[model samples]
Target: RQDPTEEIQNKREEDLNKKKKKSAPKSSYSSVLIDKDQEPTQSVI
Candidate 1:
């Protein structure tokens, strides 16, 4: 049988992993947008 405290800890870790996974794509998407925005300014300089 699993210890209840261990199970809760595992659930918390899973929640953190889920949050990281969700944020990872958002950050990458924003970075891509920033790169696109920078390219035109860099070329103009």
Candidate 2:
């Protein structure tokens, strides 16, 4: 039988890599946005 544990680990790693790639751009965008008008929004939040 195939080893399911290894398969699961591979899938989890793939998912984590995809998440990091997706978040990378979003984090950069937020940093740039806040730098423009962050103090007002930050205090409101």
Candidate 3:
């Protein structure tokens, strides 16, 4: 019973949010990347 158009709209919104996050300032973005890098190393231990 789900509407296909509504699902498409939700996907579009998610894409817009991802784009906005990518456009964020470099300092915060770098921190996010660093956290991601550390997570894998921590898991290996």
Candidate 4:
């Protein structure tokens, strides 16, 4: 049987990985700033 604490730790690591992937690249402040700078001339379809 798996230890309950080990299962919880694995679940937490998986959640953190998902969060990191979702928050990569454009989620960085530099990309956000660039998008803001371009907003004046860009339109969303």
Q: List the residue pairs that clash in candidate 1.
A: none
User: Which residue pairs in model 4 clash with each other?
Assistant: none
Residue 42's lDDT in candidate 2: 32
Cα deviation of 9 in candidate 1 (Å)? 0.2
**Candidate 3 stretches greater than 4 Å from native:** 25-45
Could you tell me the TM-score of candidate 1? 0.53
lDDT of 3: 0.70
- Candidate 4: list runs displaced more than 4 Å: 25-45
Give residue 5's error in model 1 in angstroms.
0.2
TM-score result, candidate 4: 0.53
Predicted candidate 4 versus true structure: per-residue lDDT over 1-45, tens digit per residue: 999999999999999978876878445445556768765433342
- Model 4 vs truth, CA RMSD: 9.4
Model 2 clash pairs are none
Worst ten in a row by lDDT for model 1: 36-45
Off-target runs (Cα >4 Å) in candidate 2 are: 25-45
TM, every model: 0.53, 0.49, 0.50, 0.53
Could you tell me how far off, in angstroms, the CA of residue 21 lies in candidate 1 after the best superposition?
0.2
lDDT of 3 by residue, 1-45 (tens): 779999999999999878877887555456665877664232321
